[model samples]
Target: MVRASTPSTWLQGLDIPSQLFGTTGGSDYELYEEDDEFVLTIDMPGFETDEIALAWDDGMLNVAADHTDENRGRKKTYHRRFRFPKTVDDEGIAAEYTNGVLEVRLPTADSTAQGTEIPLEG
Candidate 1:
């Protein structure tokens, strides 16, 4: 099985693709800290805004979307959870979906996330 030599918690709990399933590298979502907040963006095409659901509990944020086509007899579902290092201002969280992209802004008290990135050795 192939495995990615990446940090377990890239950008503080950002989940990358599993190499066990023949995938590797960074996560599907883009996460960065700026303006005292962590901005996360994920490309989730083919799912309507009404079908997507988001919830926050403590430091964990859950994103889920499901779409079913009766005529085609098919269902598509996507779900992911993100955990942040700093205490998130849950009330300040905002999300927007447009053109098959989902963007979420998680406000944090810190300007940078905690932890040091380990340098990879050749």
Candidate 2:
């Protein structure tokens, strides 16, 4: 399942049952580890690349965007924070925004996964 970038608190009061799912109901981003790197992609429409800001700090990634439309007198804002499981190469981190999509890659320091896996008891 694709998780939403930010939790939709405004939809929580809706009558629809799916609204209860909030951020978990739909997907606007994809995250995975490949080739010794962690890749995170977020689909953000109606915002320019310049309006978006990405920052990495202390094993956490922060994504924020703000857009203002003076003609329509409206403002849009987005903010999300993510914490990775393993140690990442901070100097090797990179990001790109194109066609309203943001993609970030963080190189892993080693091949081992951070935590011990729990055995599934069915």
Candidate 3:
């Protein structure tokens, strides 16, 4: 599913029942900037790396996961989106999942422009 830049905007119209079956549900996540990389940590227990999907488009980061609890005969879906600030380098983003936590790293914008000197002739 496509998501807007703002996460709350898409969560307002959530369908609870459908979400329990196979639709997107609200998921908890944390975003922070540290050193040269922006970090995003999301809680997604009971899901394998292959069952999750991620996408970055138009400055919006989208994450979705689906899994079935066969022992309980229940299915669940978790989804979230974040609007990255212009300071992020979208092209260098990377993700890794370990011990049920998904961590994404987004490098800071290149500094080449910051050091550029423009000459003015008036």
Candidate 4:
């Protein structure tokens, strides 16, 4: 019996796995740093206000959206993900969905810290 030839390793490198997995979606994100806080603007079209969920855990911010059955009859698939710069305080963190866009506001470290500074002298 004759043996089959294997494809080159370089061919695998050129493979676009995101397209094959069907996780590709269009999204725009903007991160801004202010004196008291950092604001994150995420663009999520075709999503409802109640279907989005945001959480902070283990120095990471997680955002997920679950579409309802209203579009179940249509052929659609989405698997987009966004990673935040730093973990935010889960308390008082609010998410607002408007006009098919999700806006998440995160308070900075300085804003969350309270108390007086200690003086050191030598």
What TM-score does each of the candidates earn? Answer: 0.69, 0.72, 0.66, 0.55
From the highest lDDT down, the ranking of the candidates is 2, 1, 3, 4
Give candidate 3 regions above 4 Å deviation: 1-27, 111-122
Q: Which clashing pairs does model 3 show?
A: none
Residue pairs with backbone atoms closer than 3 Å in model 1 (clashes):
none
Per-residue CA lDDT of model 4 for 5-121, tens digit only, reads 344466568875644634223325666766555566677787776667776775466777767565566432334444544535556566787887777777654344455889999
Error of 3 at 64 (Å): 0.3
lDDT of each: 0.80, 0.82, 0.78, 0.59
Q: Write the per-residue lDDT of candidate 1 for residues 16-120, one digit (tens) a residue.
A: 455554433334677888878889888899999999999999789999999998999999998888787657888899999999999999988544655688899
* Better candidate number, 2 or 3, judged by TM-score: 2
Model 4 misplaced regions, further than 4 Å? 1-27, 68-72, 75-87, 111-122
- Candidate 4 positional error at 66, Å: 2.0
Candidate number with the higher lDDT (1 or 4): 1
For candidate 1, give the lDDT of residue 110: 47
Query: After best superposition, candidate 3 residue 60: deviation in angstroms?
Result: 0.6
Candidate 2 colliding pairs: none
